[model samples]
Target: MNAKTPTSPVPPYPHPAGGWGSVKALGISLMRDGAPLATASALRKQNKPGGFACVGCAWAKPAKPHLAEFCENGAKATAWELTDKRATPEFFARHSLAELRGWSELELEGAGRLTEPLRYDADSDRYLPVSWDEAIAGIGRALAAQRAADPRATVFYASGRASLEASYMYQLLARLYGNNNLPDSSNMCHESTSVALPETIGVPVGTVRLDDFEQTDAIFFFGQNVGVSSPRMLHQLQEARQRGVPIVTFNPLKEVGLVHFANPQSPAQMLTPGETTISTQYLQVRNGGDLAALTGLCKWLIEADDIAQARGGARVLDAAFIAEHTQGFGAFAQAMRAADWSAIERGSGLPRDALERAAKTYAHATAVLGIYGMGLTQHREGVANVQMLSNLLLLRGNIGRPGAGICPVRGHSNVQGQRSVGITEKPELAPLDRLAELYAFEPPRERGRDTVATCEGVIDGSVRAFVGLGGNFLRAAPDSQRLAAAWAGLDLTVHVATRLNFTHVVPGRESYLLPCLGRIEIDQQAGGAQTVAVEDSTGCFHASDGVAEPAVPTLRSEAAIVAAIAQACLPPNPRVPWNDWVADYAKVRDAIEATWPDVFQGFNQRFRDPGGLPKPNAARERRWETDSGKAQFIVPPPTEHESDPSVLRLMTLRSDDQFNTSIYSLDDRFRNVWGTRRVLFMHPHDMRARGLAEGDMAHVTTVAHDGHRRELAGLRVVPYDLPRGSVGGYFPECNPLLPLQHHAHGSHVPAAKNIPVRVKSAVA
Candidate 1:
């Protein structure tokens, strides 16, 4: 490796996920942010019984949380939000929007927190400071004008990072404005699970809780890179592995954390060279082959069950559970039997013997816990992909049983909670009836636009206003360059955020950036201090109270911003006491209980409990809420993107040092990527087949053939342990190569995992 390589010479990080490396990373983050002492105080309160929830991942905290409950990323997030650095008006005045546009994601966010509201000045080509009142009032006026024309003319987007109170208020505000056009970060992540899980098990979320992990006989991981996405989960995994539980992993890449873990919380393990092995069996399936692989598992199980029953051996399938609690089993069994072994092998990139061996592991286990992430959901057949997993779970009566259920690893802290609290485009599920009765206003009943539809609306001139709660919308989107062009046509864009992002720089005609407090910052109001609740991936609604002073005095809570904007947009409504709720979040919780009595019956009281109340999952108790009043076993259609040797499957990855769109640094230690984000990972044989070397630069272009041109050039190819025809690259950068129209079948989430691409030589 020389200067020509342009990347760090270090090989792939050989160490486990969480040890001294995590400690070093946290130290660097605190040092870089200049918030060691300040963040230390915040870190002490992280994930505690009466403290703030971690913004790093949506994983739940234990009943008795560790003294230092936060993970490396958790500490980094705390340090990031509590930093002394500030991107005040002076910072914006110095950099023109065009100049800022050229900056990297890390460079943009590294400038620190936004301290004041800013309005983009076209004349000066910079953001000019504006009072919070004026900014909120302007947004209100724009929404009013949009409402006068068409309620759907404005779309309100919520980031999964906001609290439940904020999301409830945000959705209410949107509905009160005469439209249900609410889209959130979930549209880009686990919307598939929200659809698939409920259809299969009568619940949209995971049924398994923390205690279930302790009882499971076996664990299956699909698609989620827990090490990078949620390393905190590694503790549970490590404990399960140590308990002699059979841990099986199904992914295109054998991620480090899934392979092994060195628990940082344990001194005995961290002090030694030894690391605990996590996965007993690792299956490297094809990029778009998870559905095929899952179908193979079902096929193996059905055949094995028949053999066992005929031979008078012990039963392999849960006959009684299936007969009593489920429907569609016969059709599901028929599909599995009809599936060709040859087709399964080709589609799954696994031989019949290998799948059968893996099936044996599942068949032997009485109870199994299945978990998945974006790898399964961000595909054209995402709904089917998840349904296939549920099919397997049903064969063994996994759901509603101890240590046996589905776990969809969600991104963004409260993304799941956001949907739970009515942040959805579906009219029937938007709490319309209760909201209308409570507020004395008829709520919108028509279906609203999702993420994809919003993009179409942006281009067609149907939507004129864009209000984003938090997170980088433009960069996180697919066909980003195209959407950015259309975004400029919007009449107004308002971003409520704590820091700068690409969305802020890609301003609309009258763009306004309203700074909001982070989850770990003090949110004081008329009630002295405010505490909001966030629901984790497992449906634990825990309170998050900021311990540190806010990044700036001008910052407002997310709920407060939503209230002010709503007040500005609509005339005075005595029924909806927006001001009162903002002053005391408890009032907002009380409203939540009234709006959805069944789900949050004792919201205010339960939310105040230190351990937090775990919302009931009917599926956990073998109760089906589906139309048929029984669990379902759906059979998915054949894969549309069949195997093509010439076309390489390109899946996007998140660098360990980054979150969704916020890059903490350039290096990704887990993957051994350093000093650059332009590197690509592929199998060595595949690299050789393309006449490419390890360090050779290549041009990657999408093979979607959707009449849309997309490509990435000057990327250094690095031979790694991926499937033969599949390659990987970091997200957002590779995001340009993903077609906006290419999305999940039912959920419409961007199918980014297995994109058809051609890696050609760039040395012309």
Candidate 2:
């Protein structure tokens, strides 16, 4: 889907292939489980004292300290944590690891909660139940053996669900073992954003808070659909629209929900036929064409400012702020002036008039907010695209003020926080220095491998053991065909999760599945109930305490698991106080407070509110943290801007019913996709050009860069309203078509949004 193309007017439905799969599962799940017991537990936990943060999305504004604070996904996360089901020792006895591997991702997870530690017995192809002591001993032995062989062979992966305490301990253990090979999920998704943002602004997080939506005069949404990705945000957008704030959208596909969202919170609106008009103007940009659209907008705004100044009116560009806080304005402006309008129009798939109109709308606004998602970041020029966004916001002095700033819609709840707490495989000197002083041990100074590098390491035998906190690393990564093969080469593989996922099925020579506590479950230790801490997208850290008890008595919290593993693998690193921090998360928070006093003040006390304090952004206040104390702009070298007629640009999309890599069901009710994930949306003109028609099965193959042949089959082409030479399809299914090496120009983020491919009709 080209970012410049208008979205299809028809609402998307549940994907037929996957939709029915989810419906059947949901129906049975609801019937068997009844109402979630976690609801009662969560209600009790809210405000009686301090409540735990919602573990769903990183946008943790402190829970309103109210019962309604939790969203549906958050509730599901809670319910899954608090369910009555259990995967006990007996269950493992009945099923082998081989047998579990045969199960589908959804079925395996749906089986039940993990009740005991299980180790793979390759002789029988089964995972036999083992005592905790034995499991720890095996882990210790594995680490000892591997470190003796090669210290850097071990990679420590952290899931975002791991609380601050667990993540700290996890990193400490890795460093103690003499390696910083931490390849967490953050590496796969937002590492590029994290790396690029701080260089432009001082902070990697969004400068805008939820409250900013309340005060904004206009919002420019790029490549983000709130209703599907972050439904909780719909309430905010609906409120903003009701207040007469204009909502402008730039996306290739027209998301129906963005146009006419029925606020589930509004009873009357929910019952009425009318939907809220979200976008006053929608610009359809080409897939991977965001930089051009952004450049065009910036250029148009500059020209408008010149006109305004000549007419003796308010200036659109913040000349003084740019002069004081940013560098390279002259070069940026010069490049913009020199940029060809014809090139912009052709590359963006949007007309010059449309670009000018959108720019004029932005220029007229008193306050503006620019929000984008993976569509902008998962491209060849992802980092530059982000830099361009920062440039646009700076042009009007739109950041660091009330109702104006930049917002990168994060996927996971604590992804940003995980990065903050040293989850990165590539850590800078400052954090390492702080860790060295705080932990008393010299942390690994060398940069470690990221997700891409980690995969390469695994394939080449440089990495022996892979320990994941949560998530299905194999399924979520690009080039599943190759990743699965690489996993077989590992010496040891451990997955600490609540239930079955794809990672558990792909066995290493020695594998272990350790079940841990979920966010909804109560985690009790010697000191009454335990409270875990997590940071949200806005950079506010809050404590999250689970209300309901663990699904089974045998389940342990991730923090407890990390501590036990640390104790097993490495000698005591007293500087971290891993054991004490694991015992009570508050102690960890105290340590964090001690380490970084400038940011998190009285960290434990501030979480008592509904909305946490805003994280600081240097760019927002015209305070540049760069070398020159000025934000530098890059005039990216011009590249060929032609889209071949034979190949269409494919943008991977998630259905409304999906969350991250987890597909709740195939039904995208809003998008009208029913019971199918293997479908593509195309423009009628493109279909006619290729002699293709709707419902035709086609094999989509990518143009070769490194002689990698990637293709998907049996895809029905729905000739809907889409931009010419652009198409849309769900990911994981199309993942095979994306080469592992085909990533962002510099960041190695898989260019999931923009891949050039040719479609051939499948022979009957």
Candidate 3:
């Protein structure tokens, strides 16, 4: 694992995010790798009213659809799923588990759609296709055994790829079987947002809607790259720029998406080869410095307010809003005033004048929209980082305004939806009382394990079984070196997925791969074709209808598979009619309505809405639902980074040619990384300081002294537009360098954003 393949020199992609280049990339991926006509037809339906939801990211779709609503990533994902290729039983027969383990991530995925249920063959060390009946029966028997040994021995992990209905059943199965060991991708990606937003704004989800972008005077992007994360939002950002809205970006690297954008649909613009400038100012804040940068912004605003008060001038802070709607302002203001300018300057890696300018831009605008991504979440102080942004918004009454609010740009189409319906470890987050009353079972109240804790449980033999709904769980997880072996040691591991992934290769003692229908494929039940729902980032519920033919006839719907697993594993319960629910998805929706009547009432009626239906957000109405009955102005720690000066903070990057954990090819068009994912990005000054040059093979080692000397050797060094004492590399590839124990303090999200590391040139 220490040695990596040689790669081309990382040449930066100078073009804006979407344009002729994106079109070219999309065409290449689809035409060469996927069924072009099939995927193109699917793309026409993607993000449209009653169409399939792109599982790429959770960005909301516009009410009125454009000609092509899908982005390059979404299109690539659709094409990837709608491919003619198949990792069929014959393919498995040709390659043993050991041989497949030697294959690359892209190769393993390129093996394509999993045709049927596969069981691990210990003697041959290969996967042999098994009948669905025998497969689920064996899984049920093993799962029951684990539960019988100890209720906590079985853990269920659901990824964001699952639909709302499928995820609901998955969670129900876990609780009914005893224990609440439900660790999910939400815990790994945006657990910080779930924890911090509720503590500050009285809501766990973002209050801003798609229409809010139209009226926002200013937009602040904290550690988000729109081009890769969700390119569909580029159109809105472009329109905002045209309307003279100021967009200020605070990130370690100047992402091209935040730089400028070209609408691929606009014939005149595309033909003319022109792109609109996106950001008014791009400040390269150091990795792990978001807390400091945000604190500095608040500090300047506070100081200015004090000076204005002394001069008897107009008030800078929203005094009326603060007094009426928020609590803890006095403590927050005092803490901001006490923050040292020297510490802020050092921590942010930007001069005081830059902070003043950014703060003035924010103060100058009456309505400002605050948006952030995972960059602000996967840190030791991630919760505080989010709260500080909340504090800044509260300073000017940004929340509950026409064009202003806090928006956490979540990844995954149904990640929020999954969490909304109780696929979470936190008992209080869900309507547990209602679920218990309706299901006739006492749902466990004890706080359950998260992603990291789940791994620990697996390693220590406490957790004996795992069922992944979807996702490359083992590959995407942090500290791959530590988890893979322990994960294989499990008694049972069931993966319900559409296609092959790295996890399929890392089989457990008793492993089963149950292929499921893709989102683009039609999912027919006893009633007829069913529509699955997904919640976008803006608290809107979108119903998606799959219209394509199934990749294989043997593939079952996720809901049906979950129901079968439940039927096979658990004793019959009249209260929870597993068969009746799968027979009609509408009944499942009615049950979901019954479980959360306050929020989800009239769910079946709302399905008739062409566009998505907005979920009620008290924060949007300026109604504080916190324990204190008011918004909180949280005080952030002055210093965000506590590492040694020599230690560089490494933030993980996503390649343009990939979606989450699924690499399409080796080519990264945005970063211009070709033929490899082992490249490391660093500032030139930092590289010079370490006596490293471009294309130099470097060994990156974690600074953590947790007895695990996690290191990624022979990572090619590439200079990037980043601040000093910071580096970045493609995620999950460099995930090995992140120790399992190093995570967000409160949220427990792995600190993939700012891993403390030291780099040195590797020997040839």
Candidate 4:
């Protein structure tokens, strides 16, 4: 199905600034709004026995056991949570839901923390305050009514912000109610990586430990902007750079943070106005060209290894490891040799010499850390892209070794945790078996809806009630207008959020906005202060608590909210200990321990330490988990197709200044964008091809196979140093161009990164 994209109807602001001026403007705005005074105190308290978890990115690296454990974004996240602003019942009384819906997402949520449970009243076109009991009862009634008809009609989605206990309860409650349709934010982002990783290895997440970064001889950064996408990781890269480790960066656009960065922690550098030069060399690749680049690299390596082998010398490839642990090298080798250099160079936007140099570098490095992000995943061939990267790593025996493994940098702080705790749409039998053993409930053996499927269900009238843990579902979904309309069509809708957001503004037939305590807020239950465990990308789970009082007196923790709903909806399900689990989060941890042994032993006791134990990465010990007990090389078949002559491959990206669906401000200083998120960055030649100049307004139109047209206009075209035929724009705003139906093959994740669109000069 196709949805019409919005016409840039009117320029967000005429005469928009470009170049360094835009960068300076954004920097000033960032310093003004991004600086946090309470971050120090909050971080200090974070180390205390009951400090809250970070509400920011889901990198669950423990806030360094002592001192403040926060990056710049973490500080902003803390400030965002502890802000004095409040969206009280009185505020809702002043503005009707209809009026609020018209407000920009930035304005609607920028107001502040939601302080009460709100129920939308059609007569008043506004949400009126309701008691917690009343709201829970309403949700329970909605679920009961819907379940009585069709259990699959209800969509229960959880976001990363929900605690481990809370997410567990959410799944439990949904299963008890007879629906396993748990479509969470993980599906929209890293679901592809999660799905492919396990097939390649035995686990779904990255295998690299932080310690490995220190020992790595070389690192490859792909399609990720460390400076903006993950700032905390920049320090680690800086350290590696300082050690003189060679770093090769591949991206369509040259990110400033990856080029040179000034670390706040380096005193000598701070005094000397010094900067850490991150990438020894950077390769400008085209969007959706990652597979091509990987193939070229592997091709060069195979040639080198063959030459060495003929000379009766050690092969450049990991011959011993490959012989012991892989199955498909023969097939892969043939594909690599057959891959054409012209196609690789044209598709990747890199010269053959540059590709060879990168290949030589990888061949020389004793250990290499390969890191990739959404740019590789958001494409028609995202899964293939991952499999190809896995092949590259395996060729040199990069897996099951120190300082080497594929790392998909997750965005949310506990996103990895959410997946670990069973918030996935596609539940693995092993995890489900463990869940059944721990909770004593036989979870439905049937499959469930992913993000795209859930949206389709909603649109096709198959989904009745929509309950979201903490995401901006409508905004986060592709085709915002269709998603909003479908959401509005739902029989009942519930949102548990810490702050006000655009999702809260859109009303359902029976809509409820339940304000939940933020990560920074204290969650004092009947059992007294409680700490929740969160798992990081590296598989380390640790406890987090809160120091400050609840942002609002009426607010409840996600655990409490989930439990209350479960108690109210499911009719006394004797299969699970719902009440006990929600009361004391420890009970939840106890269950987690039962499900996954050894890793979470004395789960509560281990959390007391400043350092948490890292989970096992088979690669770390040279134990390959693939079928042959070794890393396997996969040579994907080439797509015998040509790019549309009229369109270019456009990648939708997040700005350095914003998080997923959470727009702090309209300033992307890293990209030199200020006071706007509507502009598109492209190469000067691409702009010239369309008769568009820098700062010239243009219309972006997408051509669907069904002859439907989706377009956005009045977007100021800015010439960037990006690869030709490649373009980049901010997400959500550009989400409309991505069809909900356009997703990866295995997981059905929308290709938000690789969209083909034609550009033209805007009329007038």
Residue 463's C-alpha lDDT in candidate 4? 85
Per-residue lDDT for 499-595 in model 3, tens only?
Answer: 7888888888999999999988999888899988888899888888997899989999999999999988888888998888898888888888888
Runs in model 2 deviating more than 4 A are 1-49, 62-67, 89-102, 309-314, 639-642
Per-residue lDDT of 156-186 in model 2, one digit per residue for the tens?
Answer: 8876777777786777778778887887776
- Of 1 and 4, the candidate ahead on TM-score is 1
lDDT, candidate 1, 119-194, per-residue tens: 9999988999999878988888888888898888899988889899999999999899888889888899898988
lDDT of 3 at 635: 76
RMSD of each: 2.2, 4.0, 2.4, 4.6
TM-score (all chains, Cα) for each model: 0.98, 0.93, 0.98, 0.93
- Considering lDDT, which of the candidate structures 1 and 2 is the better prediction for this target? 1
The 0-to-1 C-alpha lDDT of every candidate, in the order given, reads 0.88, 0.74, 0.88, 0.76
Cα error, residue 722 of model 3, in Å, equals 0.7
The 10-residue segment with the lowest total lDDT in model 4: 9-18
Off by over 4 Å in 3: 1-12
